[model samples]
Target: MFTDGRLLSDPGPILARVRHRGSPRAFVFAGVQRVPVVSEEVGQALKTLAPGDVQLFPVSVEDVDERFFIVNVVRVVDCIDEAGSTGVQHYAEDDPFPERAGEFRWISGLRILPEKTEGARAFMLKRFKHPIIVAEEVKEALERIGNLGVMFKRVTGNPGA
Candidate 1:
């Protein structure tokens, strides 16, 4: 979060570290998916949210892998901006171009730190070579999901605790 306490989860920088920081490093996929689009059942299963708000479906990444962390995906917005390009997708099926693919959803997730650990401190101190842009709605949803994670941590001693 910024100093004003707006939550954020910018995957780009952390991912860059995984790729460029470690020695003897092998490239790993962040495991993007969109096999089943959000249906009525899925929407209802998640909460009282409307089906239309759920542009991305639930992905199962529920294990402690050496290289992966289970990040909560809160929202996926249609990138109509990237319309005319070729649809070489990572999350969606063969559909990178929104014009041809119907809608391209960019993944945004929840992030938090209890009190800036060593890793968090290192991450914050790192310099960024490029601008990592995420959508506004996606950021808001991530903040909401992050608040839920914080609540869960307090109650159940789960995530972020």
Candidate 2:
């Protein structure tokens, strides 16, 4: 794992589709840049973001074997805690959603269905698809994160050897 964010827990199975609905007001301000979180702690921290809370985390990926990697977790307290915290929009101190903070369990699944990220640009994914097919650079990036050499060798089969 890259040493900065202190995210990325031990590899685990993750659901393929996740739902992290973006706030409409944020869309109005920042377009489509949603900071991806990997670990539950980071997800908890990120939940405390309003609009201007510019934090970063690693992008999640679906590896070649159908296992999910780098899932971001979310909860209600963090969202409620973030109110009026100088984000894309300002919420009054009344913070209309305090009641929502206890309504559900923490949600941590997979990709936000149809969300995009900077790392996703390194590969190709069509809508209605299940697997994330890798491009050249993306394959290299995967190698950096962990060994996928078995998959690579199975594909290449000593093409140059």
Candidate 3:
């Protein structure tokens, strides 16, 4: 999510629009600006499962009666094991956003220092917010709910030599 807590502070009404409607509905999907929109069930589960790691704000989706929420995964941790990762790149000095020159632009074969996660079940990388990292337990819990529009990549297990 791109929100930096400003969304939490803003007291304005929140509205959303679904571009399509079909079966196998996604319980968690990208809303406007890539913000996470989740079903009330998913939202409540997250609130109980990772209360300290996320914040949920109610949202009104066009023509839908079921409650939905915008999930803001609040915790940001600098735990990327850069030395252990592969295909990693940073924003270039000549890029448009020079201030982000040294920040992560892309990362494959992601690895993280488990010890540095601060016991958070869900968190985003300090400089990279594209993926929301969740602990194994959290992953299992979400999986149990089904209809998730996301996938998991193992970044904490042993690397085969």
Q: Work out the TM-score per prediction.
A: 0.19, 0.20, 0.88
Strongest candidate by lDDT? 3
Error of 2 at 5 (Å): 24
Comparing 2 with 3 on lDDT, the higher-scoring candidate is 3
Worst 10 residues of 3 by lDDT: 1-10
Pairs of colliding residues, candidate 1:
87-96
Report the CA-based lDDT of candidate 2 relative to the real structure. 0.27
Cα error, residue 60 of model 1, in Å, equals: 3.6
lDDT tens string, model 2, 1-161? 22122234444433323343432111111113322323333223333332122223333333322222232221111112222212223223455755334332222121222123322312212221112223345345445544221243211122234
Compared with the true structure, the alpha-carbon lDDT of candidate 1 equals 0.26
Taken over the whole model, the C-alpha lDDT of each candidate is 0.26, 0.27, 0.79
Candidate 3 clash figure, as a count: 0
Give lDDT tens digits, candidate 3, residues 40-99.
888888888788888888888888888888888888889999999888999999999898
Candidate 1 lDDT for residue 146 = 38
Model 3, runs deviating above 4 Å = 5-7, 24-26, 159-161
- Residues 26-101 of candidate 1 have per-residue lDDT tens digits of 1122323211222223223333332222222233222322332222223322222222323323334465543434
Best by TM-score: 3
Better of 2 and 3 by TM-score: 3
Over 4 Å off, model 2 = 1-124, 148-161
